[model samples]
Target: MPDTPAAPRFRSGAGRICLDFMRTLRLRGMDGATEELDTPEALAAWVAQLGPYPGGTKIPAPAEGVLGEARAVREAVYALLTAARSPAGPAGCPPKERGLLNRAAAAAPPVPVLDAAGSVTWTAGDPVGAVLADIARDALSLATSPALDRVRACSGPHCAAWFLDTSRPGNRRWCSMETCGNQAKKHAWRTRHATATAI
Candidate 1:
């Protein structure tokens, strides 16, 4: 019998970007590839890299003289996620601030890559910013009353990563299972074993 091909995993665009941003923030620099504070092209490339595409995906030519705009887009999403966490005081943003957020929300979706013969080829349909918009909307939707807060950063002391908690309790913490939760369990087990040995 001939082998069947594996099914393509469908991932929502915003979900991928949200995970990328979380991964970037958690590691800061050394752990993963992210935007550098200096250089426009590098920053733009970093933003582009956030897309979940295979290496064969062809990137569209960068827009002319709009590196600043790309940077603004990245920062805008960052601000929205940050603001969503703090509802009171200076947490709520003004109209001018929201203008950028809306721009990012409405930005064009990522283009598909073409083959050498100019035919349509493999592609990543979702853009990073688009995913952030969806994540923010869904994150906020969980709130049933004014008392229910929207959005939250991971409470793990070493990791301040953000995540949308759709749990019934609305008390989720760790950003990912492979990272914080596993680490916490390992730490607990070691502590328990150590105490038993000491006694």
Candidate 2:
């Protein structure tokens, strides 16, 4: 049997749902970008992975324009969060984007429920709306709360990913030490070794 394609790897280091949502725009550094949520099936799968939806809750397949709308909302949320972290105080969210978020936030909101193991999980009538609402709420909170100071864009070359610096020193620089951090370390080692060789 032919091997199945592996699912896209999402960056979870953002430490916030809204930031992670922004990460769906893959390879921001490259000319051609890969969109993780490119299809209705992909969207459905992504929603299912974000689980604790009621056992049999059926997520309606996204219609023609839904994916575009979702992407637009993600971009808006990204803009707002990045602006909050800017040296200058938070930039105002574009009116159209803000209005889009407001509509999503007003949709069927997610309900938190405790499972048998006593862990809190979420469920909603419309999975897409619920996820969007969650993202909107998170963005609003991060923008207004002191936590906004914790947001940091990764310093890796050609990397545009954002993450929350939860360290006591607040000095994080990479999205993930296992990935971009390691790459940076290797590059530095090569540079130092080359300099010594020249000497």
Candidate 3:
């Protein structure tokens, strides 16, 4: 048998977190996995399965306070994605909506938990800070980078994910064709066939 591959590790930072969450959403929804996570460890374990980061090491665990902050940011990202998917306002009015989305997407780093001595319980070992740095870079890139013409939420109902529309057509739909697009097509086909057979 082939050697069982180790899970992927994450580089300390927000991009890693974003990517991790995106994968989690995809796997839990599209892949037909029944594993239910009720705690942060579940999220961590899911990320661990992604294969090792460039270097095989665990991201330093966040201080208790940092965990809450990171969670908040993660939730905000999801909210922004959800809003973008709906045709409510953002799509109709680009400038104002983009500004609002940018503001929300700005995920601030959680302050480290400290002891009585004012020593931070979490340090460089904690990858949450690194994730924050990545978020900062990504936000700046989305704002100032001319290459980014359109940043929008994906069109898959099961996928509330965001991506820069780098395609020449600027009409990119799903976060990943293999994940959301393929799943949607398969479901539609199944429904059609099921109906035809019933008829």
Best candidate according to TM-score: 2
Q: Please provide, for model 3 over 1-199, each residue's C-alpha lDDT reduced to its tens digit, 9 standing for 90 to 100.
A: 9998764432221123343443334333455533322345544443334322333446544456654544554444444444444455224324543453355345443335678987654333334444444443344343444543466556777654556666788787776677677998899999999999999
RMSD of 3: 9.6
Alpha carbon lDDT of each predicted model: 0.48, 0.77, 0.48
| Per-prediction TM-score to the true structure, in the order listed | 0.55, 0.84, 0.52
What's the C-alpha lDDT at position 18 in model 1?
Answer: 42
lDDT per residue, candidate 1, 61-137, as tens digits? 44444445555544555555555445542246445555765555554544457788887533334343444444333
lDDT digits (tens) for residues 78-171 of candidate 2: 7677666666445576677777777777777778988899888677767787887888878878887898888888888867788888989999
Candidate 1 stretches with Cα past 4 Å from truth are 1-19, 27-55, 60-68, 89-91, 94-96, 110-150
Clashes of 2: 0
What overall lDDT, based on C-alpha atoms, would model 2 receive against the true structure?
A: 0.77
Clash pairs, candidate 1, are: 14-131
Winner of 2 and 3 under TM-score: 2
